[model samples]
Target: MTSQGLHLIRGVSHAVFRGQHDDRAEECSFRFWRCGKGFEISVDGRDVNHTEFHLLWHQLVDDNSLQNLSRFDKWFRLWSEWKTLRDVLHCPTYTLKLAKTGTDMRVAAHLVAGPVDKPAYDMLPVHVSDMDNFAKGLPVCGSESVRPGSWLGHSPGPVRGPDGRLYTLVLCEHRALDAQRGEADMPSWDRIRAYVHLAHSGVDTHCIPRLSSLVTDGGLVAGVLIDHIDSGSSVQGLVEAAVSAEQLLSLEHKLALWRDRITLTVTTLHEHGITLTTPEYGSTIHELNIEVNQHDQVCMLLSFGTVSIVVGQAELEHKTSDMDELRTVFDERLPELIVETRRRLAAA
Candidate 1:
């Protein structure tokens, strides 16, 4: 239902906003699509202003507005209700504008919703000594053993610290800054700091990696220091190995235990207002550590970037439902994967 000439960003398609049957064309309130490098949008066929569109985008996605409804539906309801009343009174229709500056789009919507001012990401500066100390005398922010380096494929680097504990430094990526800055697909370093702040204020710390310190340079966030999670092994590896033996009963038991643990993990996350995306859970289960902490074994959810703070129970339920669906797919596939593994193993 998108109007012609609307250029969508890399990872998104017009079909997302347009309902299956084109029922959402006019009914939708806003049209802000995520682009690979920036956003391409058309708000009511009017020239979209930078500031208002930015505010409106955040208002739409952040406040649990994108939970159950499609983007179009959510924005439409809000705009329609407000517009109907405003139009009847013969008021001018305010537009959401997008200002593009060298790959950065700045939109202000303070007049309609969200914070009165944009957040300025200022924090402590990151020093060479800090990186060296955290990395146990290793190099900072690049590839080398025993050093702090960027993790492969869109992740921060994990480093060994002087305290004999592992740490990871999450910094701002160029794409996230100059491109998708402010979109929920990739959180700003400041927002990550906010999540850390929330965690420090008495959320369940055991379920997540321990955040150690904030790394910055020149008053801007350079990176975040998170405790590196150590694992005896991963749940996925264990499950897959068990499945390779073709022991149905064992596989079933493993699957059951995984179901329980995953449920518990999801519960703990919800209790603290956190939700994990699909890549952070199902596909990345191999990254989750099952390690012994003190006298007991614990599960550490890795990759904070894949998580988000939900608005309410509704959003939480929606997120939890997605996790559960992924679990179901894994459960159904295990039997077949087990058979495949067993055949290959036997042949070997």
Candidate 2:
């Protein structure tokens, strides 16, 4: 069951953003990883001639000094790697077109070599069992189980790196063992992996999870090491717990802060020609992926999976749709939460 495709890199990373705290001590850990040639990447794995994608994110957006030229220069370096890989392998230019589905998405990979356009790769559906196998086989992180980030399910492993930083490991949708016994309504890792890369390549480090590695089993993506947020839970979790009127009111400033953070984050993504879709629950809580700091400030926004890079008019129109959805999520949900909290308080 060796996959000759992309995979996620195992383990966690402790990323320190520059110029945060006065003593350069205002460090927050984020996740990032690179793709290497293997069926499964080890914790100490390194991709030859490959740069960490998340580092590129930090370099581009975290620093205020970088100009548009600098950003282009940064992307040029990354494009060089892809170009080299393509040239060395004599591989055709692959255009992976993904379309949405009811439960998962369909990936249509086409090879282009000067007017010779044809199908290239198989569109395999990644199952949760494959993710479980990926987690079970990876080297155990210090002081944690094989599936460490299992709290959120879908087989996210927890790892405590040598640097003592915690991280959550997820199965990359692009690569894994082809399950003989299929699971129903399985999520697509192909789209998920693309979203992870987009988050690393599109958004800033503060508003998104740091991707540590793109772990692969030679060709397919096997697993991914992402930042483990040890901060407070999602705003949905906070609202759900607010049973008193006073407690709900206390969330006013926090909600405002979160809304502002999300708005800015979404706006920044849009500025980069990317659009993020809103969650179904009007919240990232459906995935419990949003992280709030102890001070009730949003450290990271959610739904990296929903990010789409705009290209033409159709995609551009999506920006307006996405923005409106986000506005509704942020503006409308607070009042409902307040009302629910008051009802709970009165009932008690």
For model 1, where is the 10-residue window of minimal lDDT?
81-90
| Residue ranges of candidate 2 with Cα displaced over 4 Å | 1-157, 160-164, 174-203, 278-289, 300-305
Runs in model 1 deviating more than 4 A are: 1-154, 162-165, 175-185, 188-198, 240-252, 278-305, 312-317, 346-348
Candidate 2, residues 14-47: lDDT per residue as tens digits? 1111212122212222211122111111111121
RMSD of each: 16.6, 22.2
Best by lDDT: 2
User: Could you say which candidate leads in TM-score?
Assistant: 2
TM for candidate 2 is 0.47
